[model samples]
Target: MGEKLKLYGFNNLTKALSFNIYDVCYAKTAREQKDYIDYIDEQYNAERLTGILTTLTDMIGATVLNIARQDYEPQGASVTLLIAEDSMLPRSQTQLAHLDKSHVTVHTYPEYHPETCIATFRVDIDVATCGEITPLSTLDYLIGSFDSDIITMDYRVRGFTRDVNGKKLFLDHPVTSIQDYINPEILRRYDAVDINVYAASLFHTRMMIKEPDLQNYLFKTDIYELPPLTRLEIMNNLRREMIEIFNGRNIY
Candidate 1:
């Protein structure tokens, strides 16, 4: 795996280091050119490049080569996610939390736990919008099915066959488990408050795997298409897998 990846980011580099097969080293600067000594390990160090292609290849090895060194400032942003050229992905959890009731307007501050850490952290979800669906932006509406029999707090424009009565028909997709709806920022906020306690838990980092990928998820995993009971079971299994994976990483 180490030989195959040729991966360069620090995360991938560290992962590479975890294996003994690949070699690693720092590149030599022009200062070292006077006595030019080449590094022997082909696996890790780009510490020196003989020419343009070599340098370009080395940049590929390091993951980014086009940007000027002065232009980049990795620490400039704390956290960012990828975006596709054209994406119509479902409303993100952060966005959904702020949506006004058209049906699913469930409060981020859940009943009986309004003052808990989770609720307090949800304050970050309050956002400002022009009060309408704008291009390159969307007014978060409930996207899931609404069952008419079950009163849905989640509102959506999707399930409507006709607006004649001004009441929409829905196919119910009520949240299966309250725990499954855990928010990411809440964990981040918790970690911000205390290092030791946060460090002691693996829940936050691994929980990212459970997060919905929107379209990619719909196409690849098809998890949303699964039967309700199966989805519930799978979520539990995944949570267990996440916990165990983190636990295994801690083993000596």
Candidate 2:
């Protein structure tokens, strides 16, 4: 990296990354659907989500000041972490007012269609940081942390900080697209699209898995046990579901 910008006082620019990840599966029966939801709840409980957020905090060079997590009654989990930059003052000396300035959060939603026999698990994550840290650094890890079939991301830079010359700088770093931060190997597995507003310092990206393997979409069911026709139907339904989610519209 080049020399750090010479800020007049403190870097106040706020950078935020929002992610929506969906994992789709084919559950042949109502029992399987319930089982799928239970499995997801156990796999990504509040405790596990907290662990993931803790790792992310370290990766971005932030200190966790506080955390709040909960697992819903029927299904789902949520985790929130309040963090501060490493360069910030120690907890004893720091004030509690800025706690919301930098934080990381995650919430999960698991649901299914009784008619289609398709189940989807959605995880929403938000990472916002003030000062020198950037949430982009944790993109790869977040993607790999879940079974991401369809993913949508939004990144924005808000507020301004002053330089040594007393001039305001809206954005300290250059970001043409969120895809730039994603790993190349991961990019190969998905077809991606970008919608960016350069002047506003906002970026958006949507991705869908390029290849759909029947085995990967099957939940608690053996692919070998299904007949060829059944497998084909399941594959089509799975693809349709992904397409609808990717486009944010239903197909008639």
Candidate 3:
């Protein structure tokens, strides 16, 4: 292991990771759409989201100071966790000041196109940390926690800290791209693009599944039950939806 760099006082550099994960399906009828929404709501309720975030906190070597979570009225949920970097710190020392600096949040959105019969579920997550704990270490776990068809991620390092010699350091670590932190096995499953500004310390990556099976996108419906032409149509619609989401624009 490389020798750790000693810093003067506390390391104040902030690293944040933001994710937008989309899952698409063909619901066919309004009833099926409603059922799909209900299914997603139950599968990713606030309580479940809290558990996920709590695990993430632990994975990053952070201590949870407080958690606020709620399930919405019709079909959605949100969870927020206040965290601190030093698990060994006394409760009195790990107060709102530290809690406010580090946090994890997740929110879910489920919706359906009434005309197109396409149902989509979206989950948004943000993990921000201060000091030595980098959120990049948890990318694999975060991606695995969701049914992600298309994913967009943004990572930025903000603020600065001082070294032992009193020189200011903008970034404590080296990061050329977010993909470098992701698993190669996961990278093989998707087509990914990166937009990074090295000078500004901002990196962005977008990923879409390379090949989607028809059976996987079908909800509550058997592939053998549908005619060949219907199956082809559903496949096209699903691909179109994924393309639109991956590109962030509608195709005409």
Candidate 4:
């Protein structure tokens, strides 16, 4: 463990991180689109998501008290974990103590364009913890765990914790941007932007893959199999979709 802080009492400050990841693909036929959806469902089902969450819980040095998970009809899956700050606490006792209402949750959304044959898989994850646990520590792991064509993240520190000297600290750890926590090698593969409010202890970052491989964006098809003109059109459509998502707006 690192150096401990001298606090008047238990740390009460809460740190929350929200991560949104998108995976874009092109499927020219309805059957292909349905196949893509089924693929995503199987790839990220409740069981797999639960394993990921359990690994994350261990990474952040927390103990899981309870877990509730479900796979929805038609599509999508959800997993939630209730965690405690102290790992040694008995599982049953920790659930009752409620020392910290820390939790990790994930939800999936899979959809496709009616006519365009464009498909997208989206995953939203939120990790919130009180006391010494920091959600930022899990940033890179979560990003690497998904397809991650585009990613948007927000982190904020709330409330206050008092030191032994009676000085109030709004944030226990130093953080300027969520990008700081991402691996440099991974950062090099994407274009990144940051919006931060130092006074309010808020940080946001958005990332989109740079120069994506055309073959990687195609489902059940190959770029070379198409005519030169058709290949160019498909590439343009994929980039347009990525740009629209990164900007959070539709392109005419």
What TM-score, computed on C-alpha atoms, does each candidate reach?
0.19, 0.93, 0.93, 0.92
lDDT by residue (1-252, candidate 2, tens digit) is 357665654566889999999999999798999999999999999999999999999998888999999999899999999988745434344321222358999999999998889999999999999876788978899999999999999999988877767798898777889998989999999999999999999999999999988899899889999999999999999999999999889884
Full ranking by lDDT: 2, 3, 4, 1
Per residue, candidate 4 scores C-alpha lDDT tens digits across 12-92 of 788899999999999888899999999999999999999999999999998999999999989999999998886232433
Candidate 1 per-residue C-alpha lDDT over 31-109 given as tens digits, one digit per residue, 9 for 90 to 100: 2221112212111112211122122223222222122111112111111111111112234331211122111011111
In model 4, pairs of residues that clash are: none
Whole-model lDDT values for every prediction:
0.20, 0.89, 0.88, 0.87
Q: Which regions of candidate 2 deviate over 4 angstroms?
A: 87-100
**Candidate 1 minimal-lDDT segment of 10 residues:** 12-21
Candidate 4 residue 122 C-alpha distance from true site, Å: 0.3
TM-score attained by model 2: 0.93
**Per-residue lDDT for 39 in model 2?**
96
Models, CA RMSD each:
24.3, 3.5, 3.6, 4.0
Tens-digit lDDT track of model 3 for 75-117: 9999999998762333343321222359999999999997778
